[model samples]
Target chain A: MRDAFHEDLDKISDSLVEMTRLVGSAMSRATTALLDSDLGLAEGVIENDVQIDAIRDDIDEMAVQLIAQQQPVATDLRIVVTALHMASSLERMGDLAEHVAKVARLRYPHKAVPPQANATIVEMAQIAERLVAQAGSIIAAKDVDGAEALHADDDEMDRLHRDMFVLLVDEGWEGGTESAIDVTLLARYFERFADHAVSVARQVAYLVTGEWEHKRRVGAPA
Target chain B: MRDAFHEDLDKISDSLVEMTRLVGSAMSRATTALLDSDLGLAEGVIENDVQIDAIRDDIDEMAVQLIAQQQPVATDLRIVVTALHMASSLERMGDLAEHVAKVARLRYPHKAVPPQANATIVEMAQIAERLVAQAGSIIAAKDVDGAEALHADDDEMDRLHRDMFVLLVDEGWEGGTESAIDVTLLARYFERFADHAVSVARQVAYLVTGEWEHKRRVGAPA
Candidate 1:
């Protein structure tokens, strides 16, 4: 029975890793589509979201079953429960990507704001992707150190978000109301995406260390 | 030993409910401060965050201890784990309220925008508070029905958010950049707050029902 339970838990973990990969890919593609104005890629993200949602449901079902049958205890219980939380965050990450794709489709063929603003957003997306990827790695390997590092990555995303706001305000001041509004909303979505990823990382940290470490690691030494 | 374990579990639940009450109050106070431009209230929220943070730490510690000692099974395990997720959401909710308070301080003495925009935002805050309060009740009573009702409440917040956007964009076109930018960011924060509350409601539903209910409740009479 213990062997069978362990096998089931392993299967759930694998599904979680797969879900993370798909959600991360969707986010990356969505952001790239926004930057390059690639409606085709954006459409692809929207379409692929169904698969992410399906997987999220599968994971949740599996978690419920594990609890009902296996009656998981100790670390086993934590793993199952944390998987459930991670699944929810992964699903939201997908939804945020879908939102980005919608924006991309809406603004297709029109450049978004100034080059600098677009470039900053792209950088922000990159950070978000890295954080999500690291979260996946921490979950798979239960790497506490990697999980700790994610806090700094999240802080950088926050700084970029603040910068994005400054750019949006400056652009609005310079008479680009329409484009500025688009950029501002887009930036807000990406910042929120990053925030969710940070949330996933924190969950990973809890799963690995068996503790919730709230103090964010300030940025790496200069 | 079983009786002792049950007692410990009760303590954990009590701590969770206490934290919930503190966070809910913080949100209410923060929104009131925003509406009234009360810097003292805003400062109180900023100062009170440390207490929230401390509560979070205590909950985390309790959860770890409960799992380590009792090795809870099934519903017991789910309750403890759900408490962890709820704590994280509540912490973020408090942070969002703090963000609003910060905005209030930034725009102090002078209103950020017209009374029309401010009134809509106040409405949004009221809706968010309702959802947050409902979430607390759902957890305390394990009321799946109440949790389901929050989904509709969330939709109302979404509609109000759309109205705010329309108003902001109209202001952008008519009232120029300054007014539009301020209202846009303010509206975005309130919308995000509602999103977090919806997330809390979803978690409550999952805890009670063992299913991943969509954040949007279906089949309710429009």
Candidate 2:
């Protein structure tokens, strides 16, 4: 019976890793599609997001069932509950990638991102993909160090987001309001994608340390 | 023992309702702050979001404890798990409200939504507040009809969002790129607020009917 419960817990972890992998791939492909104006890849990323959603549902259902059946307490319970949060953040990440893909599709035959903004956007996408990959490793091993590093990775994404915003609103920006909107929204999607990854990493850190330290960083009023 | 379990379940439901109420108030106040450029109200809303976060933590802890201690099965398990999802959505709604307040605070002494877009933003705020209030009632009563009606309310928000976008991109839009970003983001905050309310409502509907819906409506791949 003990072995069975541990197996269930392992399966939950496996599902989370699977979700991270799927979402990471989606972000990478979506970014490429966005950069290259590749409609097929963009459509593929959009199509694959459903799988990410389904996996998230499965992870959630499994976590709930594990708690209900095993009656896990303390650390074990925290791990299961944290899995739920991680799955949610991962699923949202996938949706952000889909948003990017949709934008790619929306502006097909014409790149939504102008040349001036492309480098920062590309770098942001690379950082986002790297963070998710790191997130998967963090989840699989409960690596607190890896989880902590995601914060810096997310900082890079934030800097890029700020840069894109500056470019969009700069006095000399020749990109019209439509392109401005496109890049603005695109930068946000990439930035939010990294934010979700950081969130998932924090969840893992919480699970490992049993201390919810990030709460204060969020600026929640005392 | 059974009665105690049911009582604990009731408490969980109460926390969810309370969370919805806090989020609703925050959105209403945030909107007013945005329109009036009231720094104090915006600060107040930002400060209050911490309480919503605390309540969410309380809900999650309670739900985890209930499952671990009672080992609830079937419908009882579903109720506990759904409450977890509801708490999460409500917490996110609060954060969205806080985002609006932050924007309001950021543009202090200067209006975020220019005169041309003010009416639509105000209407969106009212609708957001109304939906959350209805969401609170729906959670308390588990009213399926009320939950279903939130979809229509959210559709109204979507219409407003589209209108705001069109206005932003219109040839005559004199709001400039900065103001355009402000309104565009503001529109998203309200729309996402409604979307989160709809998500909670759908959770309630799923609880009552045991049929999973709204996943497709989110535009996730099939």
Best by lDDT: 2
Worst 10 residues of 1 chain A by lDDT: A213-222
Each candidate: how many clashes? 0, 0
For residue A219, model 1's alpha carbon misses the true position, in angstroms, by 15
Q: List each candidate's DockQ score.
A: 0.23, 0.48
- Candidate 2, residue A190: the lDDT equals 82
Error of model 1, residue A100, in angstroms? 1.4
- Candidate 1 - CAPRI tier? incorrect
TM-scores of the candidates are: 0.77, 0.93
Q: Residue by residue across B38-149, what tens digits does model 1's lDDT show?
A: 8899899878877876776677667756766765565565556566766766666677677777767777775565676767877887887777777767667766667557
Q: Can you tell me which runs of candidate 2 are displaced by over 4 Å?
A: A209-222, B209-222
Assess candidate 2 and give its lDDT.
Answer: 0.81
Model 2 chain B worst lDDT window (10 residues)? B213-222
